[model samples]
Target: MESCGMSFIKYLLFIFNLFFAMSGLGIIIAGALVLADVSDFSHFVTSDLVGPPIVLIVMGAIIFLVASLGCYGAIRENYKMLVAFAVFLIIIFIVEFAVGITAAVYKADFQETLKKSMKKSLEQYESSSNNNIEKAAWDNVQQKVKCCGVNGKSDWSSTPMSCCYKDKMDESDQPEEFCVSGGRNYIYKEGCYKRLQMKIESNTKILIGVGIGIAFVQVVGMFLAFWLAYTIKKEDESK
Candidate 1:
């Protein structure tokens, strides 16, 4: 019965590691997509905005490698590999915890920094003929968030078309009529900075939650790996 139980645990660890490996791959892909999409706008975006995706890709790669070690160690009953996997998990857990805490501690500062960056981008919007990526990013944000400028509509010399009230604006209306004349009433009142701050806060919370959950799982996996390694050593010594 003891041997059977050990075998069951070994298989369970392998399966868990396999699943984690796949999740790591998914994260890598997501990170890659973010990096690719933002590459053209690197000069305009703050380093903070560009850093996460690169970190995600690197961390995902590390996770996949560690998970592979765990899976193979369990399958082959390699005690050294299991120990190494546990150590890797401990290191990763510490790093992730530190990152999460830092994010929480500097949340307000990050928002303020991002707001400043957005303001700079808005100031250059009309004059930035060399970089369409930055312009497109701002336009997409305004259209999707239904907000204009870093502060308010008056931040722009003329109201952006993205801020035009959809109900009142028509294809036949000239830009001067719908976008300039009496535009304050037709444009969205809220600033893009506030909306962006809310979005950043929400995403940061979710990321922190996910990091905690993953760290918990890594702790559990480390325990299981060590236990299995001990059991294998004991069984071998008995022989």
Candidate 2:
């Protein structure tokens, strides 16, 4: 009977360690995906800054080590090893909280920057390009401008200055240039990139969901590892 109990405990410990180690790996991969956001910074007040990605990598290392220790400790019935694993879990919990808070603060800053960019874009439209110049004369205005995926080259090809929406007016209060190409309505304005804003919003929500799920998984793993460690010791005593 004692031998059976020991074997059962050992099996539980092994399963727990295996699942958690793989979970940690998944979290690490997700963190790498978040790091990829560095490529797009048009809407950020602060850059990707390297801090969060580095923290995530470090967390992955901790989780891997702790999970390994839990497995080894359970197999060997080593109390010291179990304690070490618990310590690692505590440290990881603290670090996760800190990183999460920092990200929230940064997100607020980015939102402010996005709002400012939109206002700047509106101002630029009012001050420049009254839409009166011929396509040839206004090539420069149209060149730097993109609305709904239409550029100056296509804008010139259209008749009666068909490149723009009449709703977008200039400082003189006349209808400004708009484009209906690319299956979306758009007004050409400086300092505004809605694509970047949309990207930030979408990514932020995804990251938040992923973060919560990872934290929950980690916590559950920690408790299960601790319990399994105890079970292993109890079996050894019975034997």
Candidate 3:
């Protein structure tokens, strides 16, 4: 009964490791697909597109190989093999953590740059155009617009500034939030610019989230590998 239980546990661990490794592999493949510059593959590394971190791709490959080795070690009940695989996982985790930190720093810098660029653009638009109609449109947007870090809440509101916006809009139907009541006799030119900036800010947040998640997964994978190896080694020594 004891032997059967141990066998079952080993099988379970193997499957768990395999599943994580497989998931990592899939991430790698998807990342690669995005990285490819073939005619069929839209250049995935564009500033607009969210591409997986290159460090993640490397770490994922390492995790996948370690998981494959762990499966083999479980089948053979070889403590030495398992220990080797676990050590590799630990190294990969450290590297991944370092990469995640670097990514986070880069994101901060990028966001700072984005805000500065947006401010400069707004200033230029204000300087170049002086028409009252155009000025009114910009004035409306300025009143309603919340910049990347200007307001704490109720930011990024996409309310329409004028009725002219409805006719010139790409889509016939606009969301309630984007649609202003009645007919807007005048439209703000800067409104769309501010909206575009808001989208860029939101996307930066999403990329930051992805980097954090990858870092967490690497930490978890490292811990599990080490714990499993220690337990398996102790069990073998007892026998």
My TM-score estimates for the predictions, one after another, are 0.79, 0.59, 0.51
lDDT of prediction 3: 0.52
Q: Write the residue-wise lDDT of candidate 2 on 23-83 in tens digits.
A: 6787678667766663334222334534555566567766777788877876776766876
Candidate order, TM-score descending: 1, 2, 3
- Please list the residue runs of candidate 3 whose C-alpha ends up more than 4 Å from where it truly belongs after superposition: 1-5, 29-52, 111-167, 170-220
For model 1 the TM-score comes to 0.79
Ten contiguous residues with the weakest lDDT in model 3: 37-46
Off by over 4 Å in 2: 1-3, 42-50, 113-193, 232-239
Over 1-239, each residue of candidate 1 has an lDDT whose tens digit, in order, gives 34986798799999989988986787687667766654433443558767867777898899999999999999988999999999999999888888777877877787777777887887777666666766787777877776778887788886667776645544344343335533443666668887766665555554555566677778889889989989988888888
Candidate 1: segments with Cα more than 4 A from true spot: 29-44, 126-137, 168-185
User: Candidate 3 on 2-81: residue-level lDDT in tens?
Assistant: 36655765676678677767867865765554444211111111352344434446656776877888788767767777
Task: Count clashing residue pairs per candidate.
Answer: 0, 2, 3
Identify the superior model by lDDT, candidate 2 or candidate 3. Answer: 2
Question: By how many angstroms RMSD does model 3 differ from the true structure?
Answer: 9.7
lDDT per model vs. reference: 0.75, 0.57, 0.52
Better model by lDDT: candidate 1 vs candidate 3: 1
Pairs in steric clash, model 1: none
